[model samples]
Target: MKQSALSYFQYPEMVLVPLILFFVFFMLLLFFITRPKNRELFKKMEKMPLEEEETNNESIE
Candidate 1:
């Protein structure tokens, strides 16, 4: 019974440690990828012509 309890505790370190580490690593990766992409997209959006460009395109059509 004691050994079973010990194994139950040990199973998390053996299995869950790597799983947790992978989750953290992936979260960091997702943050880095999205942060820069979002900044770039926002910068581009800031310079975009609002209603003027659309009106010009409509007149040309």
Candidate 2:
């Protein structure tokens, strides 16, 4: 049997990097399109613990 550079990508594992990158790029584009609300939602999600703490503190007061 013989192999060439083109045959390298025929190997499933070897093709994964580009496939993964493609989807990652797609997701980034989707994220950018939803920019402002995405950032606000991300910030809200990130502050969940702080909001939870505030609720706990208020209940204790």
Candidate 3:
């Protein structure tokens, strides 16, 4: 019983390290996204799809 109890966690099935790492990553991404310095980049990315479509249409037949 004693060994079983200790060994239960040896494999570490219920872990939270990954969750914390993911949360940290999400927060960092949010910080970068909200920063004013990145606004222009984001705006360009936002319009990229539309620009691509327009360019495709402008190609001669």
Candidate 4:
């Protein structure tokens, strides 16, 4: 008799750890990226490509 792949995860704890870790990692990422303190930083990053030419022109003048 052959055991299906699901049989490997017969023990709940075996699957619980990875699920918990993934959830924690996702939440932390969401929190960090959306935090108020980092808002300005993200805004600047969003405009980087658009501002490149303006910055270059100022430097040349």
Question: TM-score winner among the candidates?
Answer: 3
Point out where model 3 deviates above 4 Å: 1-14, 54-61
| Model 1 alpha-carbon miss at residue 25, Å | 0.4
Q: Rank by TM-score, highest first.
A: 3, 4, 1, 2
Instruction: Count clashes in each candidate, considering only residues at least 3 apart in sequence or on different chains.
Output: 0, 0, 0, 0
RMSD, each candidate, Å? 8.9, 7.4, 5.1, 7.6
Number of clashes found in candidate 4: 0
For candidate 1, what is the lDDT?
0.77
Question: What are the TM-scores, per candidate, against the unseen true structure?
Answer: 0.40, 0.38, 0.58, 0.55
lDDT of 1 by residue, 1-61 (tens): 9988878575546788889999999999888768865888777788887735643445644
* Alpha carbon RMSD to native, model 3: 5.1
Better of 1 and 3 by lDDT: 3
Error of 1 at 59 (Å): 48
lDDT tens digits by residue: candidate 2, 1-61: 3656667556678689899999999999998868886787787788887774533345644
For candidate 4, write residues 12-48 as lDDT tens digits. 6878999999999999999999899999999899988
Q: Give the candidate order by descending lDDT.
A: 4, 3, 2, 1
Candidate 1 residue pairs in backbone clash: none
Candidate 4 stretches greater than 4 Å from native: 1-12, 54-61
> Residue 25 deviation, candidate 3, in Å?
0.9
The TM-score of candidate 2 is 0.38
How big is the positional error of residue 51 in model 2, measured in Å on the Cα after superposition?
47
lDDT of each: 0.77, 0.78, 0.80, 0.83
Evaluate residue 38 in candidate 3 and report its C-alpha lDDT on the 0 to 100 scale. Answer: 88
Which 10 residues in a row give candidate 1 its minimum summed lDDT? Answer: 51-60
